[model samples]
Target: MNPEEIGLEKPGRAYFAPDDLNDPALTRLIFRLGLPAVAGLSINAVHHTINMVFVGMIGAHEIAAITVVLPILMMIGAIGEGLGVGVATAIGRALGSNSPQRANVTASTFMVLAVPMGIALTAGILVFRRELLGLFGASEAIMPLAEHYLIIVAFSVTLTMLQILSDFIAISEGNTRFSMWTLLGCFALNIILDPIMIFGFGFGLAGAAMATILSQIAAIAAYALYFRKRIGTLHLSARFAAFRADILKPVLSIGLPTTLTSMLSSISFAVLFTYAGFYRGDAGIAGVGIALRVLTLGMLPVIGLSLGGQAVLSFAWGAGKTPRLLAASNLLLLLTSAFCVAYGLGAVLLRYPIAAIFTDDLEIARIAALTIVVTHIPFIFFGMRQILVVLLQAQGRARLAATISIAQNGYFLLPLLFVLPHFLGFEGLLASLFLAPALTALLSAVILFTTLRQLRGDTDLPIATFTNTVSERAS
Candidate 1:
C-alpha cells in the first residue's frame, strides 16, 4: 500500500488507484473521477444533438414525432438507470467497506435481473406499441413515425441496459477513463452510421433508430471486452446459483427509488406533452422537444459530475469518512453553482441561436427560445438539489431520496401543469417546468443543510487523521 509501494506505470508517474479515494485531498479525487465522466457525457450530448439535427433535417413533422415519443423513450431508460445506479452504489460501498466478495455478487445478480427485464420490456413494447405511445399522448400524425422508430429501437434495450450498467459499474471501480472511452467509441460509431442509415439506406425514422441500436451494440461489445480484462474489484461471472438476498436488498433499496424518480420525470413530461398537444398541437411538441434537447446538453456535464460525486460520497459514507463527506458536499455545491451560472447565462444570451439549430420554423424557434430562457433561469439551484438527492441515496437515505424525488414532480410539477395552462395559456405550460425544479431545490437545500449539520457534530474520526493512519499502515 503506500503510494511508493504501489507500482507506477512508468519510472516517475503513478496512476490513480481505487485506494486513492482514501487520500485526504477530496477535491482532487472528485476531479479525477468526475472530469472523465463529464467529457464522456458532453460527447454523448453532442452526439444526440447531431442526431437531432439529422432528424430535424427530415422535416418539422419528424422532429415533432420524436418530441411526442421522447417521454416514453425516457421511461424505458428510467429502469436501466435505476438498476445501474443501484448496483453501482452497492458495488462502490462494498469496495469502500473492503468487501469485494459482495461487490462481485451484486454485479452478477444485476446481469441476471437486468437482461431478462430488458428483454421483457422489448417484448412488451412491441406487443403494445400503439397503446404505449397513445398513453404518452402521441397524436395521429406522429404515431406512425413513433411506431417506426420503436420497432427497431425496442429490441436494442438489452444492449442499452448492459451498456449503462457497465458504465456505472466501471465508474464505481474508479475506472471512469475506461467508461469514457467506451462511450466515445459508441458516439463516434453512432455519428458515422446515422447519415448512412437515414439517408444512404433511406430508412428514415427507422434508420435513425437502427443507427442508435448498432451503436449500443458496439458499446455493449466494448464493455464486455473491457470487463474481461477485469480492471475493477466487481467481476460479473456466471454466479446465478449463488444469488443471496443480502446482496440484492441494498441494490434494490437504492435503485428502486432512483428508478422511480426517473420514471416520474417521464410521467410528468408526458403529462405536460398531453397538455401541450391540447393547447398548440405539433408546434408545441416540437418547440418543447427542441428546448429540452438543448437543455440536456447543459445537464450532461452536471449529471456526469453528480455521478462522480455520488460514487465518492458513497465510498466515504461506507468508510465512515465524515470530513471527506463534508468536503464532497462543499465541492459539489461549488462546482454545480459555477456551472449553473455559466450555463444559465449562456442559455439566456444565445436562446434564439440555440433554438434555431433544431428547426428553421420561426414560430417553433421563438417558443423554444422562450422555453430555454424560462426553464434554465434556476439552473444552479436545480443542479445542486439533484446532487443532494443522489447523496441521500448514496448514504443509504433512500427513503428521504425517494420522498424528495416523488414530491418534486408529483406534489409540485403535476399540479402546476394542470393549473398554469388555464391561466397563463401555453406560456404557463413551460413555466411549470421552471417552477418544479425551483421549488424542489428549495426543499432539498433545507434537508441537505440539516443532514450535514448533524453529521458535523457526530463523534466520527476526522478525514485528516484517517488519511494519516492509512498512509502509515501502507508505509
Candidate 2:
C-alpha cells in the first residue's frame, strides 16, 4: 500500500525507508530520528527535576516523602512502558514489511489491552498504597505525605499508561515530534499549576499530585487529537482490537521480558532505597533521589536516542537490512558513549550546584553531590549497556535482554550492594550502584561482540535468524 493509503502524509520526513536507513551517513539518520525523542525525554527529565525542586521548597522531609514514592510509581508505570515497547516493535516491524493493515491491527489491539491493565494497576495501588509506600521505606513522618500524594496520582495511572501507549505508537510511526510537543505542553501546564495548587490552594504534596494528574490528562488529549488527524486510517474498532492469538503471541514474547527487565530495575531501586533508609534515614533517601534525578537528566539523551534507535532497529530488522542495522548500531554506540561521557563530566563538575538547586540544606546537598560523583564515575559504561539492552529487545532478543537486565541490575548490583557496604560503609553502597553497571558492561560487551560478529558474517542476520529461533523454541 502507498503512504497515502495508510493515511501518512506525502513527503513527510517522519517516515524512513530501508534504503534511507542503510545510507552510509547513518549518523544523520540517527540524529534525525533521535533528536525529537531526546527532546521529549529530556523535557520529562527536567519536569521531574522541577518536581523535586518544588517539593524541596517545602522541606527536606517533603522531598524525602516523594523520594520514597518515586520507585513505586516507576514499578506501577513499568507495565505500560514495557508493553508499549512491544507494541512499538510490532508496529515498526509491520511498517517495515509495508503492511499497514497489520500495523493498524497491532496498534488497535494494544489500545484495547491498555484499559484493563491500567484499571488493575490503579485498583492495586489504591488497595496496597500503604504497603507499597512502606516497602520503599516511607517512615511514619513520610508515610502520610506520600500516601496523600499517591492517592491523587493513583487516579491518573490509566491516563499515564494511555499516554505512554500513544507515544509509542507515534514513535513507531517515526513521529516523535508529536510526542515531544505533547510532553512540552503538559510540562508547561504542570509548571504553571504546581505553585498555584501547592501554595495558592494550600494543598502541599497533594497539590503536586493533582497538577501531575491534570498534566497527564492534557497530554492524553493531545495524543488523541494528533492520532485523529495524522493517523486517520488506523482501525480502532472491536474487530481489530479483539483478542487474536496470532497478534498477542509475538507481542507478549517481546513485551513480557521487557516488563520483567523494568520490574527488576524498579526492585533494585527499591532495594537501594530500603538500605539507604536504614543507613542514613530520610536524608539518604533524599540524597540518592536527588542524585538519581540529576543523573537521569544526563542520561535522558542516551535513553532518548536508544528509544529512537529501537524503532529504527525494529524496522530495519523486520526488513532484513543487515547493513543498515550494523551502521545504526555503530552510530548508536559511538554517540551514546561520547554524549554520556561528556554529560557525566559536566555532572561531576557541577554536582554541588545541581544538588543545591534541589535543596538548600547543606547536609542534603552534600549527600546528593556525593552520590552524583560516585554514581556518575561509570556513567558512560552504563549508557552503553542501556543502548545494547534496548537494541537486543528491538531485535527480538527479549529473553537475552531481560537476562542481561536481571544479571546486571539485580544479581550483580544487589550482591555488591550488601557486600560493598561492609568494606566502605554507606559510601560502598553508593559505589555499588555504579560498580554493578561497570561490571555488567563487561558482560554486555561479550554478548554484544557475539551479536556483532553474527551481524557481520556472510549468513543473513536480523529477523530471519530471530524468526527461526522463535520457531524452534515454539516447536
Candidate 3:
C-alpha cells in the first residue's frame, strides 16, 4: 500500500494510518484530505449536470424525463452513500482502535454486500418501471424518455452503488488520493463519451446512459487493481467477503439513518416534482429540476469539504483523540459556514445565466432562475445543519444523526411540502425549500451549541463513547 504505486504522493508523506490522523497541523491535513475528496466527488456529481446539459438539447420534455428520473437516481445512490458512510465509520473506528482485521472485514464485507443489493434494486425498478416512474411525476411524453434513460440506468445501479462504496472504503483508511484518481478517471471518461455518444453515435438519451455505465466500468477497474496490485491496505479478497451479523449491525445503525436522510432528501425532490407538475406542467417540472441541479453543482464544494473532514473526524473520534476531534469540528464548521455564504450569494446572482445554459425555452429559464432565487435565499443558515449532521454521524450519535438528517427534508420539509402547497399554491411549494433548511438550521444551532459548550475546555476527557444508535434505542 505504498503511495508511490498508486501515484498518491511522494514517499516521505506516508499513507494515512489511524495514528497519522493525529498530525498537529490540523488545517493542512484537512486541505490535503479535503481537496482530493472535493475534486473527485465534485467531478462525479457534476457529470450528472453535464448529462442534463447534453440532454437539454433534445427538448424540454427530454429534460423533464431526466428530471423525474433524478429523484430515483438519488434514491439508489442514497443507499450506497449511506452504506459507504457506515463502512467508513466502522472501519475508521476499527483502525483507530488498532484493529486492522476489523477494518479489513468491514471493507470486504460491504464491497460484497453492495453489488447484490444494487442488482436487487435494479430488478425491482425494472419490474415496476411504469409505476415507479409515474410515482415520481413522469407524464406520458416523459415516460418513454424516462424509460429509455432508466433501463440503461437500472442495469448500472449495481456499479454506481459499488463505486460509491468503494470510494468510502478507500477514504476510510485515509486513501483519499486513490479515491480522487478513480473518480477523476470516471469524470474524464464520462465527459469524453457524453457528446460523442449523444450526438456522434446517434444514441440520443440512451447514449448518455451507456456512457455513464461504461465510465463506471472503468472506475471499477481502477479500484479492483488498487486492491489487486496491493496499492491499498484493505483487501476485498473472497474469504473476508462472507457476511457476519456482528459486522452488519453497527454499519446499519449508522447507515440506516444516513440512507433515510438521503432518501428523504431524494423523496423531497420527487414530491417537489409532483407538485411542480400539478401546478405548472412539464415546463415547471423542467424549470425546478434545472434549478436543483444547478444548486447541486454549486454545493459540491460544501459536500466535498464535509466528506473530507468526515474521514478525519471519524478517525480522531475513533482513536478517542478528543482534543484533535474538537479542533477538527471547530474548523469544519467555520469553513463550511464561510463557503456556504459565498456560494449561496453567487448562485443567487448568477441564477438566470446558469438556468439559461440548460434550456432554450424562455419560460423554463425564467422559472428556473426564479426557483433558484426562492430556494437559495436562506442558504446561509444551512452550513451549521450540514456540518452538525456529519459531526453527529462521526460521533456515532445515530439517533441524533438520523433526526438531523431528516430535519430539513423530512420533519420540516415534508409537512411544508404538503401544507404549503395547499395554502400558497406553487409559490408555497418553492418556499418550502427555503424554509425547511432555514428552520432546520435554527434548531441545529440549539443542539450544536449545547454540545460545543460541553466540550469547551477540551479536557483529556474521552469524548463521549459512540455506540450504535440502534443499541441506544433498544436499551
- For candidate 1, list the clashing residue pairs, or say none: none
Model 2: which residue pairs collide? none
Query: In candidate 2, how many Å is residue 203 off?
Result: 1.3
The predicted structure with the larger TM-score, 1 or 2, is 1
lDDT of 3 by residue, 1-475 (tens): 9766787774433443222555788999888778888888788768878888989887788899988888888899899999999988888777766777888988888888887798899999999888889989999878999988898899999899888998888887777887887888898899899999999999998998899999999999988877876666676776887477888987999999899988998878888999999898999999999888877875676777778888888877777666677788899899888877887888899988888889889998988999999777777766788788888777778998888777888889988998999999899988898889788888899999986775554453333533342233222
How would you order the candidates by TM-score, starting with the best? 3, 1, 2
lDDT ranking, best first: 3, 1, 2
TM-score of 2: 0.91
Q: How many residue pairs clash in each candidate?
A: 0, 0, 0
Q: For candidate 1, lDDT tens digit of each residue in 23-77?
A: 6778888898888889999999999899999999999889877776677678778
Per-prediction TM-score, please? 0.92, 0.91, 0.93
- Give the distance in Å from residue 334's predicted Cα in candidate 3 to where it truly belongs: 1.1
Root mean square deviation (Cα) for candidate 1: 4.2
Model 3's TM-score against the true structure:
0.93
C-alpha lDDT of all candidate models, in order: 0.81, 0.80, 0.82
